[model samples]
Target: MSATPADRIQLTGLRAQGRHGVYDFERARGQEFVVDAVLELDLTPAARTDDVADTVHYGELAERLVAVVAGEPVDLIETLADRLLAVCLADPRVDVATVTVHKPEAPVPHTFSDVAVTMTRRRAR
Candidate 1:
């Protein structure tokens, strides 16, 4: 059997304040955006060698993700998710990236727990 997507690094609840919405008030004041990402990569090399270089550095990855979220102003969470996917895929070793962007403060008529967008991308061969 082939390796499953279970081989991955997961990061959750990554919060960053950003201006990402269609509403003018949202862009002006900004709101908290949460991120959850799963970086798919083989862990065998790192496990065998016991070396940091053999695997993805999650700390740096988190920082890079934060930069993307807090940097530019996008109109939709889908686009934000795409930008985040790019960041994960930037590491050649990452075979796939599954990301979710959550907006808890979305303007809605009714009470809602959250609004989010999730996407999964595979590296091009």
Candidate 2:
């Protein structure tokens, strides 16, 4: 994975219920999914102007991300991560967006901590 840029807006541990897995039961009974999003962009504008418009509105971002998790059913957390990344990248100011989706209550036979998938996307030149 690439290192995150110096100027970043980090939103972590966004919890939402989602029906996302391969099993039928998983799709029926939804489980909590946690998401983390890191956005890389120039913070100087916001810092200089001290204007919310100059930077990402994190509260709005959170709502949009939560909607995605609660909206549709998917087979894998990877796809979920991809969707989250897209949301972060929607802003024209964001140069890169990295997203991680965590399934703490994963249906694994063995004892484990968590199951997650992380993905990073950069704007196309």
Candidate 3:
């Protein structure tokens, strides 16, 4: 919807359960985390060919990201974000990745809307 590189794939609202937080209860009980990602690449080749293999497979990418979110424990969302970015950038076609990790069930005493972390990474030259 927004202005972005002509070539990109976006995935949003990917949910998974994981034990990640500073509080012990958070790790013990575990909670849901939502991940959003934008992968940037040259889509011209895929667009012209109309071939699935030529473009990033977002469905498969979602599965990998879910695995990271549902995997090992981490103390901060920043760590989770980095891990997701790695997964996105793993694809050779992806030139850059922007990731957002959301912790809805955060260990906050008062009511809050949400807690999230966003990060962006570029494939190494």
Candidate 4:
């Protein structure tokens, strides 16, 4: 069976504050973080049946991601991206997942735009 159009959903640019950085001050003060998630699945059953049970609930997914990102302190945005990808793939309905985390205020000595990490994961058959 092929995936329907509704099966794909994107949760974009979710803003949150978290304590993640290599520096002590960055960890103490925290900073703004943006998360973007792309979830892929088959939604035909949900659309035909008109039942929430047949589909992935994006609200719940977002909540879970938020909890994980906000709960733990990590030094690397790579770790955060990996964790978010794991969370997304945990749902059986999700076949492919992409997670992006952006740190606008990275404590780099030089002036720059921002630091961002992006990762893509696929569920193992």
Candidate 5:
């Protein structure tokens, strides 16, 4: 059987400051953006070889993801999430990648928890 989404590596709660929003104030005063990502890939190679080379190095992945959050300014978290998914799927081993971008400081008139965008992408065969 092929690797399914169930077989995954999850990275969560990565925080970064980014200027992303529709309003000018939001862009001027950057807010924290939290990210969560799930990568689906076959772990058997790594397991069998016990080699880091066979698997995704999460430290490297984290750095890349954080760079995206801090690199460019976008109007929507959805676009940010899409960019993250692109990063996640850059590896040939990864079959699917799911990313969520959280904006805790979203401008809202009422009390709320958070606003976020989630996106998933699958590699082509």
Candidate 6:
């Protein structure tokens, strides 16, 4: 028999406050960071079994991201975005991952809006 198909799951707009920046002021006074993640995985087994183990648990995923962001100080959002992608791809169930990190209180000379870095990665077939 042919295998069933998988489904796409997305976790969006997970907000967290972290101190990550190249400037001392930014590091001293932490700022809000926004994360949006999209996880593509095979949900057939999980759906049939109705078990959390069979699928990617969003709680764990969010926790992992939190751990990474709060782990240490980083100079660039790009690095943070890269690390998050690595963490997501570590899960075997994940086929594709897109991570976006937003820095709202950036140290810009003039008044401006949020700055963010977004990247997409996929597991090797």
TM-score of each: 0.95, 0.95, 0.93, 0.90, 0.95, 0.88
Ten contiguous residues minimizing lDDT sum, candidate 6: 1-10
RMSD of 3: 3.1
lDDT of 5 by residue, 1-125 (tens): 45765689999999988888889998898989999999999998988999999989988999999999888888888988998998999998999899989999999999999888888888888
How many residue pairs in model 2 have overlapping backbones?
Answer: 0
TM-score top scorer: 1
Residues 1-125, candidate 4: write the lDDT tens digits.
64554578799988888998889997898888999999988878888999998987889988989887787889999999999999999988888888999998988889888789999988888
Estimate candidate 5's RMSD in Å.
1.2
Q: Any runs in candidate 1 off by more than 4 Å, and if so which?
A: 1-3
In terms of lDDT, model 1 sits at 0.92
Off by over 4 Å in 2: 1-4
Error of 6 at 28 (Å): 1.3
**True-vs-predicted CA distance for residue 81, candidate 5, Å:** 0.5
The better candidate by TM-score, 4 or 5, is: 5
- What lDDT is obtained when candidate 4 is compared to the true structure? 0.87
User: CA shift at 77, candidate 5, in angstroms?
Assistant: 0.4
Model 3 TM-score relative to the real fold: 0.93
Q: After superposing candidate 4, which stretches have Cα over 4 Å from the reference?
A: 2-6
Expressed as tens digits, the lDDT of each residue in 43-104 for candidate 3 is 87778899999888888998999899889999999999999999998988788899999998
Please give the range of 10 consecutive residues that has the lowest summed lDDT in model 4: 1-10
Candidate 6: lDDT over CA atoms? 0.85
Q: Cα lDDT of all candidates, in order?
A: 0.92, 0.91, 0.89, 0.87, 0.90, 0.85
Off by over 4 Å in 6: 1-6
Better of 1 and 4 by lDDT: 1
- For candidate 5, the lDDT comes to 0.90
